[model samples]
Target: CPPIGLESHRIDDDQLLASSMLRHGLGAQRGRLNMQAGTNEDDFYDGAWCAEDDGRTHWLEGDTRRTTKFTGVITQGRDSQIHEDFVTSFYVGFSNDSQNWVMYSNGYEEMMFYGNVDKDTPVLTEFPEPVVARYIRIYPQRWNGSLCLRLEVLGCPLSSVSSYYAQQNEVTSTDNLDFRHHSYKDMRQLMKVVNEECPTITRIYNIGKSSRGLKIYAMEVSDNPGEHETGEPEFRYTAGLHGNEVLGRELLLLLLQFLCREFQAGNSRVRNLVTQTRIHIVPSLNPDGYELASQAGSELGNWALGHWTEEGYDLFENFPDLASALWAAEERKLVPHKFPNHHIPIPEHYLAEDTMVAVETRAIMAWMDKNPFVLGANLQGGEKLVSYPFDTARPLSETLAAAPRPPDYEDDHPELQETPDHAIFRWLAISYASAHLTMSETFRGGCHTQDVTDAMGIVQGAKWHPRAGSMNDFSYLHTNCLELSVYLGCDKFPHESELQQEWENNKESLLTFMEQVHRGIKGLVRDQQGEPIANATIVVGGINHNVKTAASGDYWRILNPGEYRVWARAEGYNPSVKTCSVFYDIGATQCDFVLARSNWKRIREIMAMNGNRPI
Candidate 1:
């Protein structure tokens, strides 16, 4: 029940306003003096490099006697940090601790706001409503250059801050901070609480270390945590790949709590998911970024902050692009492929295929290898839609001939390379958006190309903004795992108060999305002798991805209700391909395969031809 919601502003970029500002006495303070609530990057100022909004501007015009409304205000001057030109494009906003005033669903708190797009004009912000609050907060947001500015809040006080402290105390209480952002350190403490409370269904473990050697932690939630369960499908909800995107990390921690609480309370739906599936949640994959991001929002806004990993590499970019030409040159021949039939090397320079992946990415890759995750959603921020692969089809290589590439399945255009599972991906994506309260509707503003209606709130990754070397693509292609880049919203890091609402917004969708892991084909891969195939590759036809069987000879691949041709193969064994029919709304279909040794024929003759074929 949040988003005290107020939006829209008027801008007055009149340069003559500078001399007029001397008539009013107000000099804005340098960065915040205290690390107050709502003082972080997520709440007010975002970085200039982003396509999204940025910083705050606060000003106080000459003191007013009576409660009055503000009509107009002017910019005072520029402060710290600057572009080479000493000019920048920016949108300024206002905020104050005096009263809640209004908050946007996007999570920004402000009264009236405005800014300029060029260095030439002095900024003048006019308001529709009177500045009634004794204190006026004017901050800059969504700028392309420069940092820090001095502005005037042109208004009279129609409001008072007499009860500000009391209200602040109430809002800052532990109960109101339910979905508060958790630091890497806070996560550890949370994991300890989870282990203490749900000793049986949940377990906390360290998967590996990131670049800064921060222990990348995971929360295992299942009836049998940390242990392999035969025939049970495994699902993962990975968040915080971009440390600056904090909501996913918070939601995951809450989700962990949801499972433990609901399961203990005998909630049937949760009981089933927990009992029949193994779920893993890595809260903060980039702890170093999380820390930097945390600082970016607080009074410590001067810190060198960002979403990249500690070593300065985008975590998502660090993964190996198995579809790239570099992979073809180095490891393609070694790793067999099953789909698109033609094995064309993804152009060598495609993304960072040749460069070493960041330590964090490698850790995730290793952890993924140890489990059979049928379905997953990589929680990220920056948009408010569910996106599916193939994030990219061809490399950004100069050698890439202009002739429409291999994915010419549609228009003879290479840019339209849809994944083999495009149909199913679309369905699953719609399922999430439809379940969302507002996401199903259309949004038209900054960032995306069009209002999201034709495809609903779901989008194709490459189509929206063709990115390279994404975690979703790598996981889907190499592991045969299905992962959706779930963009929670535009604010990568929102105020803590907005986090709970975010969790609620995505909760139902989250559950329904995870349930998708149970819609495809799942079973065991055993040898003719009935022995387990510890790590056999299971590839679903038409889909370029594969799911490997676990140590218990079990594998799971979730797909939308449909028929699929499944092929299971292991080292030194004859391959087995079978057809399986999956129905709508039905549970997973079980299809087991028995592979015979490639040398079984020679052995059969050596042992005096067997009387019958081994079952």
Candidate 2:
């Protein structure tokens, strides 16, 4: 019989019985199994090897060359001309050499993995934890008439920085190339394939539909798929907002593939990221525009046709004009300390039924309202630098006419508005810029000579070029997510041949930015009874801007290293304050709050009936 197999990896533990091996490298040495083969009387006839059913003493085994880490394994039943036999249950064993071996255990005892029930279908069983071994043997305790198997060891070579890099490093670009950009359908298929291959850590979801009724998809990569975990900071990377700017979309797709592959291969850095952070990647926000852009091919057709949505709206500039509203709120404030810098509400006009806001923009707004995302980056093109919010600043007239403001206010730079989290935002921007291949190069001027040259490869968004209703500003003002506008390069749409280099240029930055989600403080706010309190306001002393806890009672705040007082308060609870010392050497500092319910509940109920709330 032949081996019908899927590639996967796994590890084992101690207490093994004596068993003879068939041979090493069953899948690696031999050619691939007939993936399309069925029980055609000749299926797996010559490809599979079977062990003698001598009282369950005989077993099949293979070698991994050197010491290697395994995550799971894929196995198949046999379908030969003479017989149809398969192992229904089996035990896996691992060893450094061929002599002493450890049985794959469920932490309590040896685990018996289920094999294929039929002859052709493949069964995959992943290990509870990663196993390190060179030799892997299968002990079939139970079989369907006979102990026959075909298998493949799924894993990478030895783990090393250089090897990892070498595995991902692509060939140099040339004029004659076979590369082509993925169409909307191709992108969807690619995402689906990734989700299928790495189902444990990936989830495919649709935020909404495009103007042309195309589903706008977003993929989440996390240890716990589909649901957000408490205390874990949520981060997002969105691209293809302007469909003509294709590099960001390609880079994100590449990133999705890379993360899935590396995580399965037992890459520690990637494993930690997947386990600790909830990452959201929206590869194409404007699928309608992308479809138009992709129709243009690599170097022909209208480049400007897909710069916006099918309805001819710039998605970036289609959000609610919250910048003006924020400015207005600030101007009407009785005191400088009472300025509304965080969680600014959307103006009513933008949410009206007859408004011309793009459907994609509204979907994103609703998405933001649901997820407590702490960090985000919007990938774009036409330059090579990272610009952090506020992307929209107070008008020059207002800056000149307003009364005295806070000390951090920059009257001299009216076009640039600094958030209370400016230092942290700048640090995040620099982290990405410095990690990028050429974004921080001082000698290179800019992608296009006319672009602004920043020594740190970063700038304030409004300072670079103010635009109303920018996504960066919208993200900052309307939600807990602080976002940066990352300009990939000068070319809005480059040839597909350049995608490899483009991915290489942005890979490290993408990984680093996701890792930055852990750099700030995060925790939960609960009442005296230990129940989580939703919508609790968390205010850092001396910073007017504040954040609200999610429905899970968890909150994440990105802060620079410093000692400061943090407070968590609910409407009917006594606010609790604590002093936290954030350090540069560690991940987010944990700061939990336990608020006590106020005794004036009856008074609050009376006030509620009167349509009034206590301060």
Candidate 3:
């Protein structure tokens, strides 16, 4: 359920006017008010001592009741004061209808008060479990001659917040409007709607909650469970882990709506994938950051609100170990020299690292652990690059490395043959570059290949560290998942026009990239009989062409096409080697092999008779 707001009423007098004036001084603007005073009155006031009129009691004669709408759960400030007079008491009231009101705070009426007209003071208030309220009012009792009251309301209005993002301006009108842009609230609404509309394949689960106590939700989309007897290989896409990088969230939402509608309409490809592969998505991993970023412009407030310490300058570089250490030793202690640190007084509250890891990263890691899917991609922005693991410089942890290499007939271990393949990763890199690069051939010149050993090392050494507990790294290293982290662009939020155009231009390519990854994974391993071979060694020559097969006889490697020899060898058989021709097919192919046994006895007799056998 969504968090609700609280409403309060105040008696108008000199003190109230003074308090309103003071609020205006503190940047609080006057809101719309409802009054019951007679029309066209110059100044509607009953002398000093006003009458306790019936309608006046609730609606206040000539008195205006202004309302402030907050989107989420509201909390008061701590420095709150009521003019020159000290606040004696304050009580919060709630009502389903504007007409009826009742005291809703715990029996303890006085939440907090101040001695002087100084800073705003926050009052402790708690909403009922699963808060769902339309109206909340606060009544403050004054200590001086006239009772002037004011209640500082906190939290955003869920209704307005949700509706504000219902319809977003697209890059172009031709793009489907049903692919609605979404915010945090829209994500929640969309999930509920999706689940209700397509119960068979749509499911909404709580991965965890954000630092601000907002539920971190995940949606799983697939065909009816039994469509594929063995829960099909899964593919995952996640977005919004960094609050400011919101385009992915919007794209994710659009994707979900698109797939759901297509599936319901019996779109063959959509149906096939949904029924054949489980697709799980975490649209917004950092809801708190999302809301803060949405409220505080993309760049300004995002880095300031979480467990971040550094102020003023951007904290984007804080994720890496070196930056974190530098920040802790220097920037963390240095307050923003330009502005007061009142907004983010505590370093932990501002840095966001502690909260981001505990809340967002943990949930994502847990989910990856359970699914162990074949393919996963984490979408981020600010770089036009696609990266793969081991993004952190760790050695490849897959069991294929330990399995036997192909009977090299030259390299050391001929007895232990049939390891998994590594070409899938290389192919994954080339295919990705082919599909997404603005300059089709440019990526080929740069660092682009899925060879974890060499490719990831260069990526890390180049300071690309999307690897710290990254969902992609977690999926690949910890499970049998082939993962990649995709950077949409090299700059922060390109112009709306450019972003829309880019997405339009790349939609087909993006889909193609996914399809290629799927196909690449499927073609990694097979036996001479064309049967899927488990634990087979598939090697491609390079700095080091080595890979082992999985229990399913599947091996994934990424590589570029050139003259390369592929060999398959097993014990009790003559090693088979072939100069295989492999290239980017833009489609699928079958690469299987067979091995013949070596006749040692016949060779021995021939060698003894001819005296030509070399021991």
Candidate 4:
């Protein structure tokens, strides 16, 4: 069953103002409230309290639990029973105890936030930065009728404290690779400390919060921390889609720590990778589920409890159905030249206002939309193999099925739907599998007796087992990203003592997989005038799929070792073709393109100037 108010967990903006605010962890009615000298705490709710006209010092305080980290406050004026009484303007004060208080200041002056005007509509005010405080005081400076209100505090529990000792020594030390599961808060603190330790090369930011309001954090390590440089490929590794899949998440954290330490110690490979590529690692996407699973511990417990989001949705299958939309277009012959195998827009229905996509899914979709990631992989557990895209087995729509089809369709493999880049995808899968210590073993007695063994430690996702709305398929079809699903091991949540071995087994493979992003051809596309052309299409000769250059006119295409014709096409410019080859040992083949003004476009312009004369 879904939790109370789960239906209202949509985040449309920065401020949550209505009664719906309570659904987003703003629980004021349940907090301890303190009133001014002459006012009763109950008066702020039903009855109205007015400040003296002289205004010496009158306020109301809402104090949350001891460890709550305060982000902001949401306040409702008096209820309709009162005469539209409300605080018009207010100053906020923060305090750990009720004794010492500090006013929220804008450097020099104390900040004043405007409150509600009506009796029902709530108003919100956020702090400049998040403050860990138990008590927050609202001192009203102005009022409509009287300074009367109800209050709600906005924050999650302060997960862990950042200690000086940890930040200075343990954070950047490669010696202390702790082999344990980090709770959501602990993971966040670790990332924070890492960022602090390596401020120049590391960035920590949240994508979005889970249904339970825990942040989904992504840490980026690059030459330039937050900015995406020109011609640099963006690669990401995401883990913890199923909350019980704990190994991947811990491994990612270890990878983060290792990268930080190695780069600081001037490790050439780490420094080169950071300098040339933008690497983003999202350690845990399902923090709420992870919390539940971690609480239940790793000793052969019920594996299904925290496999889904707290809202009872499996995030792996929660993305919008994009594959069907693409197939429908191809079946209808709507594609003019060839089927669009890349950057397929999401279905209109999925983006509709009333759609019920999980918050985590929406956050990641938005994240992908912003980053032109060239390669990615979502790490999972419960298996020990690497799987590539098209993880669905459903038949096409009735309209699509009725159209004329090829004769080979009857003999086609329905279980596996390969992408246009199937060869490269397979190579990618094999790369990870080959690097892992035991993934390639024919039969290591399986995870359990009944467990199935994967041949060569790699397989197409749909062939393994049909599942829809998978992140790998979504990334391949809907964006410029080629993503894979790598199942780490048999146990979804291994015992804590086994973590060190698991890290040793997977560490080299993780680094090797990240290094693979630089294997393909990368270059900039520009016009004859030497101006970079944004949104230029990069098309491989035979492959129908296409990818667009990034905002910086830079593009990256991962290809297997071969010679091929590649074209760069942009509006108002003549297309340019180049032959690029990837070798077995070479890192990346540079293939830059410079397009000229289109002759046909020039003729059209001349004809228009000559009063529609034919060219």
- What lDDT does each candidate get? 0.61, 0.74, 0.44, 0.73
TM-score to true structure, per model: 0.68, 0.68, 0.45, 0.67
Candidate 3 steric clashes: 59
Candidate that beats the other on TM-score, 3 or 4, i.e. the better one: 4
Between prediction 2 and prediction 4, the one with superior lDDT is 2
- Candidate 2 displacement at residue 83 in angstroms: 81
Residue-pair clashes per prediction, in order, are 31, 10, 59, 0
Give residue 38's lDDT in candidate 2 (0 to 100): 27
Give the alpha carbon lDDT tens digit for every residue of 341-437 in model 1: 2223233553354556677776787787777677888888756788887776554334444456565444534545676678888988988888975
lDDT of 2 by residue, 1-615 (tens): 011112101111121222432332122222122212222433221334455334676666665445567776667665355657667888888888788989999889999888777666556667778788766777778877556665655544464322343335434533222235788888888999999989999999999999999998999999999998988889999999998788888888888888898899899999999999999999899988888877755333232558889989999878877778777766677323555567777878878988998989999999999899999998987677999877776676555656677888655555567877889898999989999876886554543232364588898877767778988888887798889889887556665645766776787899998888888688899987899999999899887778899999999888888998998988889888899888886489999999988877878778989889554
Q: What TM-score does structure 3 among the candidates reach? A: 0.45
Tens-digit lDDT track of model 3 for 106-129: 356534323224212222333442
Off by over 4 Å in 1: 1-177, 298-304, 326-355, 393-414, 445-449, 452-455, 539-545, 571-577, 597-615
Off by over 4 Å in 4: 1-175, 336-339, 394-415, 445-454, 599-615
The list of candidate 2 runs beyond 4 A from truth reads 1-180, 301-303, 334-339, 397-414, 450-453, 601-615
How would the candidate models be sorted by lDDT, starting from the highest? Answer: 2, 4, 1, 3
Q: List the lowest-lDDT window of 10 residues for candidate 2.
A: 1-10
Query: Residue 522's C-alpha lDDT in candidate 1?
Result: 84
